[model samples]
Target: MIFNRVSYGFAAAAAGAFLFFAPAAQAMTKIERVVSPGGIEAWLVREPSVPLIAMEFSFKGGANQDPVGKPGVAYMAAASLDEGAGDLDAKAFQARAERNAVELSFRASRDEVRGSLKVLSDRKAEGFDLLRLALTKPRFDQEPVERIRAQMLTALKRETTSPNEIGSRLWWRTAFPNHPYSLPTNGTLESVPTIVRDDLTGFVSRTLARDNLKVGVVGDIDAKTLGTVLDQVFGALPAKSDLRAVPQARPEAVGKRLEVQLDVPQTVVAFGGSGIPRKDPDFIPAFIVNHILGGGSFSSRLYNEVREKRGLAYSVYSYLLPLDAAALFMGGTQTRADKANEAVGLIEEEIKRLAENGPTEDELEKSKSYLKGSYALNFDTSTKIAGQLVQLQVDDLGIDYWERRNGLIEAVTLDDVKRVARRLLNGGVLFTVVGRTQTAASAKQGG
Candidate 1:
């Protein structure tokens, strides 16, 4: 499945070294809007320096569109797309892909059916055709279907009691009760067994179409040429998507605390509260405020108070999860089971402190400088730019967003930061803790 949402609420950011090429990357990124002969639209960034082409595209329906009592239908459908199609069986299709060195895959994310393709410039033709077939004519033969099902079943069994998985799932379920947004993107063990061939076929027919699509391409391609390829690949699909409308959802039960008992030594903690959606005017400020609160790694208040000063945990962090239907601010930490209560209490203290007193002028300036400087890394490679383009389209951020983004960050005044801090953090966050077999009482408010 398209697992851009796969990390759930607590997936830690992978540690990495910074490669700063901010100036050149900013100058080199000139996004062009490309419309095909058949009127398919795509965002293109040309990087002739690279000999490869990478494309990312998505249709707006995802695993959330899973039928009632049948979560993971879209996931199974996405995973099975390349197993077989048209004249090629699963083996033949995979062999062709391997021989051509073309990388192509599809996923069912919470909000979209997403796909990515990468190929040597010379092999792009094979790659695009393979993507077309996979999108339009998947065979979904029984053998490959059975194999993938078994693999998914194995993973589900392994994760049945996993601390992180259990805590993350619980957080979502509790936050969005009885809503499709609460359903596991991967179908549950109970739901997966009942899924049959028709569900897969039906998901493809209803969800994958031109009207709901967005495309992005980068590396060694001109707008004129990509226009033709776009039509050849996506032009044949039906113009309209047959999708059920998903309503806007808000996270429920703020300040509610729940815990699961397990034997693990480290308690896994997930906490979050109301968020300003990406489209909100306050999101950029919220983004900056969040960086100061917990998103900035070593420099954040949470890391400094809980880990740097008290040494209660090796890591602590948070993020703004603005889904298509909901806006959420979430964070997580792992610490000694005995220290879970302390870590959580400190986190609560920092959030309320920031909400009551906005970040200092120096902290605000540092966060802005860091955000502007780090943005260049987003465009350092063709793949990264392509991914960003697709996401920009998904967010409906205008074509000029890249040009305007840093300016928006620069425009946030101290007053703006304070206003958004209360907007996002004034109310306390919900908490879900796993691995503290002894009940850790609710987070106590104190300095």
Candidate 2:
């Protein structure tokens, strides 16, 4: 899902333009911290060049907070927030948003519920008011509740037949069997219909609190003004959250392969194992090692070995997925059903090679240069800037992260990469494949 690109057209345009003209030379971003009179705090970046303002915020509770039988409560709650709020009905609220060119949206990931707002500077008051209303007084009207629930149900049904979707679902389910991470962020078909208005309301009431909130604002707003707006938007929420403590978990079913027999042309193979957490000292080194192994686009070893030389798959890559409660090294590729075993074998061989020999100096330098150059993409637009700032807060990266990031990457030596490679790549791997493969079926049956 991290790779899925949802088009916020204007936001995309701004990001694209910013990147296009960005200098190859790197520079540190200036970030300001603003604390409100009500004790609310936010990260702020002022950019008066654009008349529009973008704010991104997140709360700690997410799908992880859903009750045992209510898998998608947080997700459904996100969908219903803007449908109706305070005194406005669904249609009326939407109409008011459209009239002022305000863009408001919410999303639920495995660890957090995030919201984004974009509006013209002239309409800041209206935009802030609408957001406050949504946060504090969402109606969760029956019509909208049923409508959104139906939509999620439809998506779940569709996923049943999608190889990529099915493979991902089964991978997590198999990897974290007893943990909340095993459940789909969007509830299953059975769980979705059981969600009610009270479920949605309860999720919002318990999760949206001052203690767990992180916010970032960009464009046409000063610290003083943003401080006032922060309190106005968030001060009314409860000071504390009622979230349950999620226990730490790691991927299970390691060194095992599971197969689902779907009649798809290409087999979808999802593989992962243990990973370094964001707070770990070895994370940056692990990141550099991952880039050389698979995270780098076409230049990566996996891409070259799997796609170019052997033609086993069109794409192959891996990444470090550091969630709040768990960290993972995950990757996937699609290949002919009959070639699934061969593809998996090749991936394992490549991992072994990286673990044993590490990357060449040439590869390491190239990866470092690419990473340093692309850093500007993270701050290409007001929305993107705010989003990155909020994420930094969530990761507990210091306020000076932007300034320190490149130096951290630059300090990763060849020795460090090799050490982390052995640390991470030498672990047991879990593989989940969905397709018509005799080898896969045999593995599933313990053959």
Compared with the true structure, the alpha-carbon lDDT of candidate 2 equals 0.85
lDDT of 1 by residue, 1-447 (tens): 242212111112111111211125544458889999999999988767556687999899998788888998998999999898889998998888777766777888788988888777777888889889999899999999998898777777766778788887888887888888888888888888899999999999999999999998887789999999999999888899899888898888788778888778788998977888998999999999999999999899999999999999999999999988889999999999889889888998999999999999999999999999888778775567777899999999998898899999999999999999998998778888888645853432110
Model 2: lowest-lDDT 10 consecutive positions: 19-28
Report model 2's TM-score to 2 decimal places.
0.94
Write candidate 2's Cα lDDT for 179-264 as tens digits: 89999898888899898888888899999999999998877778999999998999999999999999999898888888888888
lDDT of 2 at 439: 57
Candidate 1 has what TM-score?
A: 0.93
Instruction: List the RMSD of every prediction in angstroms.
Output: 5.6, 3.3
Error of 1 at 318 (Å): 0.8
lDDT of 1: 0.84
TM-scores for candidates 1 onward, in order: 0.93, 0.94
Stretches > 4 Å off in candidate 1: 1-23, 26-28, 440-447
**How does each model score on lDDT?**
0.84, 0.85
